[model samples]
Target: MTQTEKYIWLLNTIHRSRGRGLSLKEISDKWRDYMAKEKPLDRATFNRWKAAIELQFKVDIKCNKSGGYRYYIANPEDIEDDKVSKWLLDSVSMGTTLMGNLDIKDRILLEQIPSGLVHLAPIVAAMKSNHRLQITYRGFGSYFSSTFPISPLCVKLYKNRWYVVGQCFYREKWQEMIYGLDRIEEARVLDETFKYPEDFNAENFFEGTLGVSLYEKVKIETIRIRVEYPHAHYVKTLPIHPSQKLIVDENGEYAEFDITVRPTEEFFMEMLRGGALIEVLSPDYVVEQMKGWVNDLYNVYNRK
Candidate 1:
Protein backbone atom coordinates (compact mmCIF):
# COMPACT_ATOMS: atom_id res chain seq x y z
CA MET A 1 0.00 0.00 0.00
CA THR A 2 1.04 3.59 -0.51
CA GLN A 3 2.34 5.64 2.43
CA THR A 4 -0.88 7.65 2.43
CA GLU A 5 -3.01 4.54 2.73
CA LYS A 6 -0.74 3.24 5.48
CA TYR A 7 -1.09 6.55 7.31
CA ILE A 8 -4.89 6.38 7.10
CA TRP A 9 -4.84 2.81 8.43
CA LEU A 10 -2.53 3.93 11.23
CA LEU A 11 -4.89 6.76 12.13
CA ASN A 12 -7.80 4.37 12.12
CA THR A 13 -5.82 2.12 14.44
CA ILE A 14 -5.05 4.94 16.87
CA HIS A 15 -8.74 5.80 17.00
CA ARG A 16 -9.51 2.15 17.61
CA SER A 17 -6.93 1.66 20.38
CA ARG A 18 -9.26 3.26 22.96
CA GLY A 19 -6.63 4.42 25.45
CA ARG A 20 -4.72 7.43 26.80
CA GLY A 21 -2.28 7.13 23.90
CA LEU A 22 0.56 5.25 22.24
CA SER A 23 4.03 6.76 22.44
CA LEU A 24 6.14 7.45 19.31
CA LYS A 25 8.41 4.55 20.32
CA GLU A 26 5.43 2.23 20.77
CA ILE A 27 3.99 3.27 17.39
CA SER A 28 7.34 2.91 15.65
CA ASP A 29 7.84 -0.55 17.14
CA LYS A 30 4.40 -1.73 16.03
CA TRP A 31 4.68 -0.18 12.55
CA ARG A 32 8.18 -1.55 12.05
CA ASP A 33 7.09 -5.02 13.00
CA TYR A 34 4.03 -4.78 10.75
CA MET A 35 6.00 -3.47 7.80
CA ALA A 36 8.77 -5.98 8.27
CA LYS A 37 6.28 -8.83 7.93
CA GLU A 38 4.64 -7.28 4.88
CA LYS A 39 7.55 -5.58 3.11
CA PRO A 40 10.14 -3.10 4.37
CA LEU A 41 9.78 0.38 5.84
CA ASP A 42 12.51 2.60 7.34
CA ARG A 43 12.16 4.85 10.40
CA ALA A 44 12.55 7.99 8.29
CA THR A 45 9.86 6.77 5.90
CA PHE A 46 7.42 6.25 8.76
CA ASN A 47 8.18 9.71 10.21
CA ARG A 48 7.63 11.32 6.82
CA TRP A 49 4.38 9.39 6.45
CA LYS A 50 3.17 10.60 9.85
CA ALA A 51 4.07 14.21 9.03
CA ALA A 52 2.28 13.99 5.67
CA ILE A 53 -0.85 12.67 7.32
CA GLU A 54 -0.81 15.44 9.93
CA LEU A 55 -0.42 18.14 7.30
CA GLN A 56 -2.90 16.74 4.78
CA PHE A 57 -5.64 15.15 6.91
CA LYS A 58 -5.70 17.84 9.65
CA VAL A 59 -5.26 14.98 12.07
CA ASP A 60 -2.68 15.80 14.69
CA ILE A 61 -1.35 12.70 16.42
CA LYS A 62 0.32 14.48 19.31
CA CYS A 63 3.45 13.24 21.03
CA ASN A 64 4.25 14.32 24.59
CA LYS A 65 7.75 14.71 26.04
CA SER A 66 6.86 11.68 28.19
CA GLY A 67 6.80 9.75 24.85
CA GLY A 68 3.02 9.35 24.80
CA TYR A 69 1.12 9.71 21.51
CA ARG A 70 -2.67 9.87 21.37
CA TYR A 71 -5.43 10.47 18.84
CA TYR A 72 -8.14 13.03 19.43
CA ILE A 73 -11.29 11.62 17.99
CA ALA A 74 -13.48 14.49 16.74
CA ASN A 75 -16.25 12.89 18.78
CA PRO A 76 -15.77 9.88 21.02
CA GLU A 77 -18.40 7.12 21.16
CA ASP A 78 -19.78 8.30 17.82
CA ILE A 79 -20.91 5.10 16.09
CA GLU A 80 -21.15 5.38 12.30
CA ASP A 81 -24.75 4.20 12.02
CA ASP A 82 -25.91 5.83 15.25
CA LYS A 83 -24.38 9.20 14.42
CA VAL A 84 -24.95 9.43 10.64
CA SER A 85 -27.53 6.81 9.76
CA LYS A 86 -30.18 9.36 8.85
CA TRP A 87 -27.69 11.30 6.73
CA LEU A 88 -26.79 8.12 4.84
CA LEU A 89 -30.43 7.34 4.13
CA ASP A 90 -31.07 10.89 2.95
CA SER A 91 -27.98 10.80 0.74
CA VAL A 92 -29.17 7.66 -1.04
CA SER A 93 -32.64 9.12 -1.57
CA MET A 94 -31.15 12.36 -2.90
CA GLY A 95 -28.76 10.40 -5.10
CA THR A 96 -31.72 9.06 -7.04
CA THR A 97 -32.87 12.59 -7.81
CA LEU A 98 -29.35 13.49 -8.93
CA MET A 99 -28.80 10.28 -10.90
CA GLY A 100 -32.36 9.97 -12.32
CA ASN A 101 -32.70 6.21 -11.59
CA LEU A 102 -30.68 3.21 -10.52
CA ASP A 103 -30.83 -0.56 -10.42
CA ILE A 104 -30.85 -2.81 -7.35
CA LYS A 105 -27.07 -3.18 -6.94
CA ASP A 106 -26.48 0.53 -7.54
CA ARG A 107 -29.11 1.48 -4.97
CA ILE A 108 -27.41 -0.75 -2.42
CA LEU A 109 -23.97 0.69 -3.19
CA LEU A 110 -25.24 4.24 -3.00
CA GLU A 111 -26.84 3.54 0.37
CA GLN A 112 -23.49 2.29 1.65
CA ILE A 113 -21.65 5.52 0.83
CA PRO A 114 -21.53 7.55 4.09
CA SER A 115 -21.16 10.82 2.19
CA GLY A 116 -23.33 9.89 -0.84
CA LEU A 117 -20.40 10.38 -3.18
CA VAL A 118 -20.94 8.31 -6.34
CA HIS A 119 -17.52 6.63 -6.19
CA LEU A 120 -15.58 9.39 -7.92
CA ALA A 121 -12.15 7.80 -7.35
CA PRO A 122 -12.34 5.34 -10.24
CA ILE A 123 -13.56 7.98 -12.65
CA VAL A 124 -10.94 10.44 -11.46
CA ALA A 125 -8.19 7.85 -11.76
CA ALA A 126 -9.21 7.06 -15.32
CA MET A 127 -9.11 10.74 -16.22
CA LYS A 128 -5.73 11.23 -14.62
CA SER A 129 -4.31 8.18 -16.37
CA ASN A 130 -5.46 9.62 -19.71
CA HIS A 131 -7.20 6.35 -20.45
CA ARG A 132 -10.43 6.12 -22.45
CA LEU A 133 -13.50 5.34 -20.36
CA GLN A 134 -16.50 3.08 -20.77
CA ILE A 135 -19.59 4.79 -19.48
CA THR A 136 -23.36 4.35 -19.42
CA TYR A 137 -24.81 7.73 -20.28
CA ARG A 138 -28.25 9.29 -20.70
CA GLY A 139 -28.57 12.05 -23.26
CA PHE A 140 -30.79 15.18 -23.29
CA GLY A 141 -33.95 13.19 -24.01
CA SER A 142 -33.38 10.51 -21.33
CA TYR A 143 -32.09 8.04 -23.88
CA PHE A 144 -29.56 5.63 -22.33
CA SER A 145 -26.70 3.76 -23.96
CA SER A 146 -23.28 2.32 -23.23
CA THR A 147 -20.27 3.76 -24.98
CA PHE A 148 -16.68 2.51 -24.65
CA PRO A 149 -14.36 5.30 -25.64
CA ILE A 150 -15.09 8.67 -24.09
CA SER A 151 -12.12 10.94 -23.32
CA PRO A 152 -12.78 12.89 -20.14
CA LEU A 153 -11.45 16.36 -19.42
CA CYS A 154 -12.86 17.10 -15.98
CA VAL A 155 -15.49 15.94 -13.53
CA LYS A 156 -17.99 18.49 -12.26
CA LEU A 157 -20.66 18.46 -9.57
CA TYR A 158 -23.85 20.48 -10.12
CA LYS A 159 -26.69 20.41 -7.58
CA ASN A 160 -25.40 17.09 -6.19
CA ARG A 161 -25.15 15.33 -9.55
CA TRP A 162 -21.81 14.41 -11.16
CA TYR A 163 -20.97 15.16 -14.78
CA VAL A 164 -17.90 14.62 -16.95
CA VAL A 165 -17.24 17.43 -19.35
CA GLY A 166 -15.15 15.84 -22.08
CA GLN A 167 -14.65 14.93 -25.69
CA CYS A 168 -16.72 12.15 -27.24
CA PHE A 169 -14.25 10.44 -29.52
CA TYR A 170 -16.95 8.51 -31.34
CA ARG A 171 -19.04 11.63 -32.01
CA GLU A 172 -16.01 13.86 -32.73
CA LYS A 173 -17.19 16.76 -30.54
CA TRP A 174 -16.78 18.06 -27.03
CA GLN A 175 -19.78 17.29 -24.82
CA GLU A 176 -20.62 17.31 -21.14
CA MET A 177 -22.36 14.08 -20.11
CA ILE A 178 -23.68 13.29 -16.65
CA TYR A 179 -22.58 9.88 -15.42
CA GLY A 180 -24.56 8.29 -12.63
CA LEU A 181 -21.65 6.89 -10.65
CA ASP A 182 -24.16 4.73 -8.81
CA ARG A 183 -25.45 3.41 -12.13
CA ILE A 184 -22.08 3.01 -13.78
CA GLU A 185 -22.32 -0.58 -15.07
CA GLU A 186 -18.59 -0.98 -15.56
CA ALA A 187 -15.47 1.13 -16.16
CA ARG A 188 -12.28 -0.02 -17.85
CA VAL A 189 -9.20 2.07 -18.52
CA LEU A 190 -8.09 1.45 -22.08
CA ASP A 191 -4.45 1.14 -23.10
CA GLU A 192 -4.87 4.01 -25.54
CA THR A 193 -4.28 7.38 -23.91
CA PHE A 194 -5.44 10.77 -25.12
CA LYS A 195 -4.33 14.26 -24.14
CA TYR A 196 -6.77 16.93 -22.99
CA PRO A 197 -6.64 20.01 -25.21
CA GLU A 198 -4.08 22.43 -23.74
CA ASP A 199 -6.55 25.30 -23.90
CA PHE A 200 -9.59 23.54 -22.40
CA ASN A 201 -10.06 24.83 -18.85
CA ALA A 202 -13.35 23.59 -17.39
CA GLU A 203 -13.70 26.56 -15.00
CA ASN A 204 -13.07 29.04 -17.81
CA PHE A 205 -15.54 27.20 -20.03
CA PHE A 206 -18.54 27.51 -17.67
CA GLU A 207 -17.71 30.78 -15.91
CA GLY A 208 -21.07 32.42 -16.70
CA THR A 209 -24.69 31.21 -17.04
CA LEU A 210 -26.76 30.15 -14.06
CA GLY A 211 -26.18 26.41 -14.41
CA VAL A 212 -24.16 24.14 -16.70
CA SER A 213 -25.38 25.40 -20.06
CA LEU A 214 -22.64 27.00 -22.18
CA TYR A 215 -22.85 29.70 -24.79
CA GLU A 216 -20.33 31.08 -27.30
CA LYS A 217 -20.93 34.77 -26.55
CA VAL A 218 -22.90 36.32 -23.71
CA LYS A 219 -24.32 39.85 -23.75
CA ILE A 220 -24.59 41.58 -20.35
CA GLU A 221 -27.87 43.47 -19.91
CA THR A 222 -28.52 45.95 -17.13
CA ILE A 223 -31.91 45.45 -15.44
CA ARG A 224 -33.39 48.28 -13.33
CA ILE A 225 -36.28 47.68 -10.97
CA ARG A 226 -38.23 49.72 -8.36
CA VAL A 227 -39.13 48.12 -5.01
CA GLU A 228 -41.20 49.62 -2.17
CA TYR A 229 -40.97 48.75 1.56
CA PRO A 230 -41.77 47.01 3.91
CA HIS A 231 -42.35 44.51 1.13
CA ALA A 232 -38.87 45.65 0.08
CA HIS A 233 -37.61 43.77 3.15
CA TYR A 234 -37.71 40.69 0.88
CA VAL A 235 -35.30 42.27 -1.59
CA LYS A 236 -33.10 43.83 1.08
CA THR A 237 -32.42 40.46 2.66
CA LEU A 238 -31.97 38.92 -0.74
CA PRO A 239 -30.29 40.90 -3.48
CA ILE A 240 -30.80 39.28 -6.90
CA HIS A 241 -27.07 38.84 -7.60
CA PRO A 242 -23.67 40.18 -6.63
CA SER A 243 -23.92 42.68 -9.47
CA GLN A 244 -27.02 44.28 -7.93
CA LYS A 245 -26.66 47.89 -6.68
CA LEU A 246 -29.08 50.28 -5.02
CA ILE A 247 -29.58 53.25 -7.37
CA VAL A 248 -31.48 55.78 -5.19
CA ASP A 249 -34.54 56.25 -3.01
CA GLU A 250 -37.04 58.71 -4.49
CA ASN A 251 -38.23 60.79 -1.47
CA GLY A 252 -37.18 57.89 0.79
CA GLU A 253 -40.23 55.87 -0.23
CA TYR A 254 -39.05 53.29 -2.78
CA ALA A 255 -35.58 52.30 -3.94
CA GLU A 256 -34.18 51.26 -7.30
CA PHE A 257 -31.51 48.65 -8.06
CA ASP A 258 -29.58 47.99 -11.23
CA ILE A 259 -28.51 44.37 -11.84
CA THR A 260 -26.45 43.08 -14.70
CA VAL A 261 -27.02 39.56 -16.00
CA ARG A 262 -27.00 37.53 -19.16
CA PRO A 263 -30.86 37.66 -19.03
CA THR A 264 -31.22 33.88 -18.81
CA GLU A 265 -34.60 32.11 -18.62
CA GLU A 266 -34.20 31.56 -14.87
CA PHE A 267 -33.35 35.24 -14.26
CA PHE A 268 -36.32 36.26 -16.47
CA MET A 269 -38.66 34.10 -14.41
CA GLU A 270 -37.31 35.58 -11.18
CA MET A 271 -38.10 39.07 -12.48
CA LEU A 272 -41.66 38.01 -13.32
CA ARG A 273 -42.13 36.36 -9.93
CA GLY A 274 -41.55 39.75 -8.28
CA GLY A 275 -44.88 40.76 -9.97
CA ALA A 276 -46.24 44.27 -9.28
CA LEU A 277 -43.95 44.54 -6.25
CA ILE A 278 -41.06 45.16 -8.63
CA GLU A 279 -41.25 47.11 -11.87
CA VAL A 280 -38.81 46.42 -14.72
CA LEU A 281 -37.69 49.84 -15.94
CA SER A 282 -34.83 49.69 -18.36
CA PRO A 283 -33.38 48.37 -21.66
CA ASP A 284 -36.52 48.75 -23.81
CA TYR A 285 -35.95 45.23 -25.23
CA VAL A 286 -36.19 43.60 -21.78
CA VAL A 287 -39.37 45.53 -21.02
CA GLU A 288 -40.84 44.51 -24.38
CA GLN A 289 -39.88 40.87 -23.89
CA MET A 290 -41.45 40.72 -20.42
CA LYS A 291 -44.65 42.29 -21.79
CA GLY A 292 -44.70 39.78 -24.64
CA TRP A 293 -44.34 36.84 -22.27
CA VAL A 294 -47.05 38.23 -19.95
CA ASN A 295 -49.39 38.77 -22.87
CA ASP A 296 -48.75 35.27 -24.14
CA LEU A 297 -49.55 33.80 -20.72
CA TYR A 298 -52.63 36.03 -20.46
CA ASN A 299 -53.90 34.91 -23.87
CA VAL A 300 -53.38 31.29 -22.93
CA TYR A 301 -55.53 31.70 -19.82
CA ASN A 302 -58.12 33.91 -21.56
CA ARG A 303 -58.66 31.60 -24.57
CA LYS A 304 -62.13 29.91 -24.82
Candidate 2:
Protein backbone atom coordinates (compact mmCIF):
# COMPACT_ATOMS: atom_id res chain seq x y z
CA MET A 1 0.00 0.00 0.00
CA THR A 2 1.07 3.57 -0.58
CA GLN A 3 1.83 6.03 2.27
CA THR A 4 -1.58 7.73 1.87
CA GLU A 5 -3.43 4.39 2.05
CA LYS A 6 -1.41 3.44 5.11
CA TYR A 7 -2.36 6.69 6.82
CA ILE A 8 -6.05 6.10 6.04
CA TRP A 9 -5.80 2.55 7.39
CA LEU A 10 -4.30 3.92 10.60
CA LEU A 11 -7.18 6.41 10.96
CA ASN A 12 -9.84 3.78 10.24
CA THR A 13 -8.25 1.42 12.76
CA ILE A 14 -8.10 4.03 15.51
CA HIS A 15 -11.57 5.41 14.71
CA ARG A 16 -13.13 1.94 14.84
CA SER A 17 -11.18 0.96 17.93
CA ARG A 18 -12.30 4.23 19.62
CA GLY A 19 -12.75 3.76 23.39
CA ARG A 20 -10.93 0.41 23.35
CA GLY A 21 -7.68 2.11 22.29
CA LEU A 22 -4.96 0.26 20.40
CA SER A 23 -1.54 -0.50 21.75
CA LEU A 24 1.59 0.31 19.65
CA LYS A 25 2.35 -3.36 19.04
CA GLU A 26 -1.24 -4.12 18.02
CA ILE A 27 -1.30 -1.16 15.57
CA SER A 28 2.08 -2.18 14.13
CA ASP A 29 0.92 -5.77 13.63
CA LYS A 30 -2.32 -4.64 11.94
CA TRP A 31 -0.40 -2.25 9.66
CA ARG A 32 2.03 -5.05 8.69
CA ASP A 33 -0.83 -7.44 7.95
CA TYR A 34 -2.89 -4.85 6.08
CA MET A 35 0.01 -3.89 3.78
CA ALA A 36 0.89 -7.60 3.38
CA LYS A 37 4.51 -6.74 4.17
CA GLU A 38 7.01 -8.10 6.66
CA LYS A 39 8.21 -4.66 7.75
CA PRO A 40 6.55 -3.37 10.95
CA LEU A 41 6.17 0.26 11.93
CA ASP A 42 9.01 1.45 14.11
CA ARG A 43 8.38 3.90 16.99
CA ALA A 44 9.86 6.88 15.10
CA THR A 45 7.89 6.10 11.91
CA PHE A 46 4.64 5.56 13.86
CA ASN A 47 5.11 8.90 15.68
CA ARG A 48 5.67 10.70 12.38
CA TRP A 49 2.56 9.14 10.84
CA LYS A 50 0.51 9.98 13.95
CA ALA A 51 1.62 13.65 13.83
CA ALA A 52 0.85 13.86 10.11
CA ILE A 53 -2.56 12.31 10.67
CA GLU A 54 -3.35 14.86 13.37
CA LEU A 55 -2.27 17.74 11.14
CA GLN A 56 -4.11 16.52 8.05
CA PHE A 57 -7.35 15.22 9.63
CA LYS A 58 -7.45 17.48 12.69
CA VAL A 59 -8.01 14.36 14.75
CA ASP A 60 -5.78 14.14 17.78
CA ILE A 61 -4.34 10.69 18.46
CA LYS A 62 -3.25 10.61 22.09
CA CYS A 63 -1.66 7.87 24.17
CA ASN A 64 -2.98 6.87 27.57
CA LYS A 65 0.18 6.12 29.60
CA SER A 66 -1.81 4.51 32.44
CA GLY A 67 -3.58 2.12 30.05
CA GLY A 68 -0.47 0.40 28.72
CA TYR A 69 0.25 3.30 26.31
CA ARG A 70 -2.82 2.60 24.16
CA TYR A 71 -3.58 5.27 21.52
CA TYR A 72 -7.04 6.70 20.77
CA ILE A 73 -8.73 9.81 19.38
CA ALA A 74 -8.53 12.51 22.05
CA ASN A 75 -11.53 14.49 20.74
CA PRO A 76 -13.81 12.03 19.00
CA GLU A 77 -16.84 14.29 19.60
CA ASP A 78 -15.27 17.08 17.58
CA ILE A 79 -14.64 14.72 14.67
CA GLU A 80 -18.22 13.46 14.79
CA ASP A 81 -19.93 16.85 15.16
CA ASP A 82 -17.83 18.96 12.82
CA LYS A 83 -19.56 19.25 9.40
CA VAL A 84 -16.33 19.48 7.38
CA SER A 85 -14.71 16.59 9.25
CA LYS A 86 -17.83 14.43 9.01
CA TRP A 87 -18.09 15.05 5.25
CA LEU A 88 -14.38 14.26 4.82
CA LEU A 89 -14.67 11.00 6.74
CA ASP A 90 -17.86 10.00 4.90
CA SER A 91 -16.29 10.73 1.50
CA VAL A 92 -13.15 8.82 2.38
CA SER A 93 -15.14 5.87 3.68
CA MET A 94 -17.36 5.76 0.57
CA GLY A 95 -14.36 6.06 -1.77
CA THR A 96 -12.50 3.25 -0.01
CA THR A 97 -15.61 1.04 -0.04
CA LEU A 98 -16.16 1.69 -3.76
CA MET A 99 -12.49 0.95 -4.49
CA GLY A 100 -12.88 -2.48 -2.93
CA ASN A 101 -15.91 -3.29 -5.09
CA LEU A 102 -15.33 -1.60 -8.43
CA ASP A 103 -16.74 -4.63 -10.33
CA ILE A 104 -20.24 -3.93 -8.90
CA LYS A 105 -20.37 -0.24 -9.87
CA ASP A 106 -23.47 -0.77 -12.01
CA ARG A 107 -25.31 -2.39 -9.10
CA ILE A 108 -25.11 0.64 -6.85
CA LEU A 109 -27.29 3.75 -7.30
CA LEU A 110 -26.15 7.29 -6.52
CA GLU A 111 -27.88 10.67 -6.47
CA GLN A 112 -26.59 13.33 -8.83
CA ILE A 113 -26.01 16.91 -7.63
CA PRO A 114 -24.76 18.88 -10.61
CA SER A 115 -25.17 22.58 -9.83
CA GLY A 116 -24.08 23.14 -6.21
CA LEU A 117 -20.54 21.87 -6.67
CA VAL A 118 -19.41 23.87 -9.71
CA HIS A 119 -18.95 27.13 -7.79
CA LEU A 120 -18.49 25.73 -4.27
CA ALA A 121 -14.76 26.43 -4.15
CA PRO A 122 -15.03 30.16 -4.87
CA ILE A 123 -18.06 30.61 -2.54
CA VAL A 124 -16.19 28.88 0.28
CA ALA A 125 -13.13 31.04 -0.35
CA ALA A 126 -15.26 34.18 -0.26
CA MET A 127 -16.90 33.10 3.00
CA LYS A 128 -13.54 32.38 4.61
CA SER A 129 -12.07 35.74 3.64
CA ASN A 130 -15.30 37.61 4.58
CA HIS A 131 -15.26 39.06 1.09
CA ARG A 132 -18.26 40.46 -0.73
CA LEU A 133 -19.37 38.74 -3.94
CA GLN A 134 -20.83 40.14 -7.16
CA ILE A 135 -23.18 37.36 -8.24
CA THR A 136 -25.19 37.21 -11.43
CA TYR A 137 -28.22 35.08 -10.56
CA ARG A 138 -31.55 34.00 -12.06
CA GLY A 139 -34.30 32.46 -9.96
CA PHE A 140 -36.41 29.61 -11.27
CA GLY A 141 -39.16 30.70 -13.73
CA SER A 142 -37.62 34.11 -14.29
CA TYR A 143 -36.86 35.19 -17.85
CA PHE A 144 -34.17 37.70 -16.85
CA SER A 145 -31.09 37.35 -14.65
CA SER A 146 -29.82 40.06 -12.32
CA THR A 147 -26.38 41.00 -11.03
CA PHE A 148 -26.07 42.06 -7.40
CA PRO A 149 -23.56 42.50 -4.61
CA ILE A 150 -23.80 40.32 -1.51
CA SER A 151 -21.73 39.64 1.58
CA PRO A 152 -21.32 35.85 1.64
CA LEU A 153 -21.98 34.71 5.17
CA CYS A 154 -22.17 30.92 5.00
CA VAL A 155 -22.95 27.98 2.76
CA LYS A 156 -25.56 25.33 3.61
CA LEU A 157 -26.49 21.98 2.07
CA TYR A 158 -30.10 20.81 2.05
CA LYS A 159 -31.82 18.03 0.10
CA ASN A 160 -28.77 17.54 -2.19
CA ARG A 161 -28.52 21.25 -3.09
CA TRP A 162 -26.24 23.99 -1.81
CA TYR A 163 -27.49 27.46 -0.81
CA VAL A 164 -25.53 30.52 0.17
CA VAL A 165 -27.22 32.77 2.75
CA GLY A 166 -25.92 36.28 3.07
CA GLN A 167 -26.63 40.00 3.11
CA CYS A 168 -27.83 41.29 -0.26
CA PHE A 169 -27.44 45.00 -1.04
CA TYR A 170 -29.79 45.09 -4.04
CA ARG A 171 -32.72 46.46 -2.05
CA GLU A 172 -32.92 49.94 -0.54
CA LYS A 173 -31.78 48.46 2.77
CA TRP A 174 -29.55 45.40 3.06
CA GLN A 175 -31.52 42.24 3.77
CA GLU A 176 -30.52 38.60 4.30
CA MET A 177 -31.31 36.39 1.31
CA ILE A 178 -30.67 32.83 0.28
CA TYR A 179 -29.18 32.35 -3.19
CA GLY A 180 -29.16 28.91 -4.75
CA LEU A 181 -25.64 28.12 -5.89
CA ASP A 182 -27.01 26.49 -9.02
CA ARG A 183 -28.89 29.65 -9.95
CA ILE A 184 -25.78 31.79 -9.71
CA GLU A 185 -24.57 32.37 -13.29
CA GLU A 186 -21.38 33.98 -12.06
CA ALA A 187 -19.81 34.78 -8.68
CA ARG A 188 -16.80 37.10 -8.50
CA VAL A 189 -15.22 37.81 -5.13
CA LEU A 190 -14.73 41.50 -4.51
CA ASP A 191 -11.55 42.88 -2.94
CA GLU A 192 -13.64 44.70 -0.32
CA THR A 193 -14.51 42.61 2.75
CA PHE A 194 -17.45 42.89 5.15
CA LYS A 195 -17.89 41.95 8.77
CA TYR A 196 -19.82 38.74 9.35
CA PRO A 197 -22.51 39.58 11.89
CA GLU A 198 -21.14 38.86 15.37
CA ASP A 199 -24.28 37.06 16.52
CA PHE A 200 -25.25 35.36 13.25
CA ASN A 201 -24.96 31.60 13.51
CA ALA A 202 -25.79 29.54 10.41
CA GLU A 203 -27.24 26.63 12.37
CA ASN A 204 -29.33 28.80 14.67
CA PHE A 205 -30.60 30.89 11.78
CA PHE A 206 -32.71 27.98 10.51
CA GLU A 207 -33.39 26.37 13.89
CA GLY A 208 -37.15 26.95 13.96
CA THR A 209 -37.79 26.12 10.30
CA LEU A 210 -37.86 22.94 8.26
CA GLY A 211 -35.32 22.63 5.43
CA VAL A 212 -33.49 25.72 4.10
CA SER A 213 -36.38 28.10 3.52
CA LEU A 214 -36.91 30.09 6.69
CA TYR A 215 -39.91 32.38 7.19
CA GLU A 216 -38.19 34.79 9.52
CA LYS A 217 -41.42 36.50 10.55
CA VAL A 218 -43.41 33.29 10.95
CA LYS A 219 -44.22 32.05 14.42
CA ILE A 220 -43.03 28.58 15.38
CA GLU A 221 -45.75 26.20 16.60
CA THR A 222 -46.09 22.64 17.78
CA ILE A 223 -47.23 20.63 14.75
CA ARG A 224 -49.09 17.41 15.54
CA ILE A 225 -49.29 14.66 12.92
CA ARG A 226 -51.28 11.44 13.02
CA VAL A 227 -49.62 8.64 11.10
CA GLU A 228 -51.12 5.23 10.42
CA TYR A 229 -49.66 1.73 10.25
CA PRO A 230 -46.30 0.92 8.51
CA HIS A 231 -45.59 4.61 7.82
CA ALA A 232 -45.68 5.32 11.54
CA HIS A 233 -43.02 2.67 12.01
CA TYR A 234 -40.84 4.43 9.44
CA VAL A 235 -41.34 7.84 11.07
CA LYS A 236 -40.54 6.38 14.49
CA THR A 237 -37.28 4.93 13.28
CA LEU A 238 -36.31 8.00 11.24
CA PRO A 239 -37.86 11.09 12.80
CA ILE A 240 -39.19 13.83 10.50
CA HIS A 241 -37.52 16.47 12.63
CA PRO A 242 -35.16 16.66 15.58
CA SER A 243 -37.94 17.79 17.94
CA GLN A 244 -40.30 14.98 16.93
CA LYS A 245 -41.88 13.23 19.92
CA LEU A 246 -44.28 10.32 20.04
CA ILE A 247 -47.46 11.52 21.73
CA VAL A 248 -49.80 8.55 21.34
CA ASP A 249 -49.92 4.84 20.46
CA GLU A 250 -46.22 4.47 19.64
CA ASN A 251 -46.23 0.71 18.94
CA GLY A 252 -49.87 0.40 17.95
CA GLU A 253 -51.53 0.46 14.52
CA TYR A 254 -51.59 4.27 14.55
CA ALA A 255 -49.36 6.88 16.16
CA GLU A 256 -49.39 10.61 16.87
CA PHE A 257 -46.30 12.78 16.94
CA ASP A 258 -45.58 16.34 17.97
CA ILE A 259 -42.87 18.48 16.36
CA THR A 260 -42.04 22.08 17.26
CA VAL A 261 -41.21 23.92 14.06
CA ARG A 262 -42.37 26.70 11.83
CA PRO A 263 -45.23 25.76 9.49
CA THR A 264 -43.10 26.29 6.43
CA GLU A 265 -44.11 25.10 2.95
CA GLU A 266 -41.35 22.49 3.00
CA PHE A 267 -42.71 21.01 6.23
CA PHE A 268 -46.19 20.80 4.73
CA MET A 269 -44.77 19.28 1.54
CA GLU A 270 -43.02 16.63 3.61
CA MET A 271 -46.31 15.79 5.29
CA LEU A 272 -48.01 15.74 1.90
CA ARG A 273 -45.37 13.32 0.65
CA GLY A 274 -46.68 10.80 3.20
CA GLY A 275 -49.94 10.65 1.16
CA ALA A 276 -52.78 8.75 2.82
CA LEU A 277 -50.49 7.44 5.55
CA ILE A 278 -50.44 10.71 7.50
CA GLU A 279 -52.80 13.53 8.59
CA VAL A 280 -52.26 16.96 10.04
CA LEU A 281 -53.90 16.86 13.48
CA SER A 282 -53.56 20.23 15.14
CA PRO A 283 -53.15 24.03 15.12
CA ASP A 284 -56.51 24.81 13.49
CA TYR A 285 -54.98 27.12 10.87
CA VAL A 286 -52.50 24.56 9.62
CA VAL A 287 -55.17 21.86 9.49
CA GLU A 288 -57.41 24.15 7.41
CA GLN A 289 -54.50 25.18 5.20
CA MET A 290 -53.68 21.54 4.50
CA LYS A 291 -57.34 20.83 3.72
CA GLY A 292 -57.38 23.78 1.33
CA TRP A 293 -54.29 22.44 -0.43
CA VAL A 294 -55.89 19.01 -0.69
CA ASN A 295 -59.04 20.59 -2.10
CA ASP A 296 -56.96 22.50 -4.64
CA LEU A 297 -55.32 19.23 -5.74
CA TYR A 298 -58.75 17.59 -6.01
CA ASN A 299 -60.09 20.50 -8.05
CA VAL A 300 -57.12 20.35 -10.43
CA TYR A 301 -57.62 16.61 -11.02
CA ASN A 302 -61.45 16.71 -11.15
CA ARG A 303 -61.66 19.67 -13.57
CA LYS A 304 -63.61 19.17 -16.83
lDDT of 2: 0.86
Runs of candidate 1 with Cα error greater than 4 angstroms are: 1-54, 57-119, 143-148, 170-191, 222-260, 270-281
lDDT of 1 by residue, 214-244 (tens): 5546566788888876656677777776568
- Per-candidate Cα RMSD to the true structure, in Å, reads 11.8, 3.3
Report the number of the highest-lDDT candidate: 2
TM-score of each: 0.49, 0.84
Task: Give one digit per residue, the lDDT tens place, for model 2 in 1-304.
Answer: 3566557767878888989899999999986775454588889999989988888888899999999999999999987888777776767766666766778999988898857577788889999999998889999999999998899888888778899997986558887899899899999999989998998998788887788887877899998999999889999998998789999985668899999999888888898899889999999999998898788878998996
Lowest lDDT 10-residue stretch of candidate 1 = 79-88
lDDT of 2 at 63: 94
In candidate 1 the C-alpha lDDT for residue 192 amounts to 77
| Candidate 1 global TM-score | 0.49
